[model samples]
Target: MTKTILITGASSGIGKETARLFQAKGWNVIATMRNPDSESELSTLENVWVTKLDVLDLDSITKAVNDGIQKFGGIDVLLNNAGYGAYGPLESFSRDKILRQFNTNVIGLLDVTKAVLPHFRQNKKGLIINISSIGGKITFPLGALYHGTKFAVEGISESLHYEVEQFGGQVKIVEPGMIATEFSGRSFDFSNDDSMVEYQKIVGALMGAMPAMAQNASPSSVVAEVIFEAATDGKNQLRYTAGEDAKMLIANRQQYDDATFIGGIKAQFGL
Candidate 1:
């Protein structure tokens, strides 16, 4: 039987790579993004359906899921990889920006998962892989909003597993460190008020450190491989960390207390 995987934010980065990987492995892929018209590569692939799906839009979520299921017969896996990084100080953001972050990352994920649950329930088996970040377990200098949303994803995926497991559904989380992608380009949102003098030092520090930090970024393909493993390994694992940096950082976070961990971050940021 041919299995199908539905991937959100599949126009680029880890999502696009994962779509290609699964398709190559003989799985039908529904590669969804906010604007499918702009996509050229994945659309040309066999057994890959490129469709429109904006995470903030519930109607689009439902329609995308239904359309994919219909196109591929049935969806065996769902990869919730549609989210951007919202950085900068919390106070610098407008209400709309704040709401957009939470809505897209938190509420929108729940809505998509809700739409897919019925199909999984009917089939008696399914896997949901959420693309969280290393930040989900540890905080950065100016990622309050971004980290907050990922933290929410961690909690949500953990709790939802218990409920979904009763019906043979499983939830898995992939925590990837800095990935070599356009994530810092079109997918990144940074808000800052220059007039806010208090945040200048930390902002400058983060900006200065970014280049060096990016030097060690693992390619999106690395995370894609991990996603493939999570989908097919069929293990009872709940969390999989991708990238050497993510493994080391997550291990440190698990080993250290609040003061020690936070102090380490502060020292790294020159705070």
Candidate 2:
């Protein structure tokens, strides 16, 4: 049987890898992005139908969903992978920044899920895997708001699993640690507001540690395989950690209670 899958934020990173992975595996891919033409790598793929979908725009989401269904018979899985990083301190972060986080991470995800529910209900079975992060469970000093959005994804995805059981739909969350993507370089899209400048000591340490952190993370392909496994055989498990780093991070999160964690963070940056 041919399975159809819809992936958002397919322009790059983990989403890009998943699009290619599934397409090679014989799955019909409806890959959506804010701008499709710019995604030459994805658009050139024979199995993927790259389309425009600005998650921030409700109508764009609706159109993309309809387009996916039109291109493929019906979507068997939907991977909500669209998101951006917002850095800085809570006090310094703008409400607009925070709101955009929720809007893109929470509301946009919910809208697309809602758009797909009826179709899944009609099909009698479907899967939804949301891309969360290690930060979702254990956050860092300056990542307050981005962590909040991931936590929201965790909460929403788990609960939706409960709500959709009667309808034969299942939901799962895939939390990944730092991967060797342009996530750090390109994903730092937030206004880099002078968030914790007052706490220069703490902030500087964290900043210095980032270069090392990026070096250690695995490539996006590792995370994509995890998503593929979860989507293929996700028997109602609520969450799957995408990489070994995520596994260790989640397992020892409690060991570094705030004080130790911050200390280690500072030590890395030579603070």
| Model 1 lDDT tens row, 82-116 | 88898898889999999999999888889989999
TM-score of every candidate = 0.98, 0.92
Clashing pairs in 2: none
Highest TM-score, which number? 1
Which consecutive 10 residues in model 1 have the weakest lDDT in total?
179-188
Worst 10 residues of 2 by lDDT: 187-196
Error of 1 at 171 (Å): 0.4
Please provide, for model 2 over 1-271, each residue's C-alpha lDDT reduced to its tens digit, 9 standing for 90 to 100: 7898899898888899999999999899999999898878877888689999888998999999997898787899999999877876667667887898889988899999999999999888889989999988987667777888999899998888887787888998999998886545566653444544676665666677778788769788999999999988847588899878788878777677878876765555576
Clashes of each: 0, 0
lDDT of each: 0.92, 0.84
In model 2, how many backbone clashes occur? 0
Extract clashing residue pairs from model 1: none
Q: How many backbone clashes does candidate 1 have?
A: 0
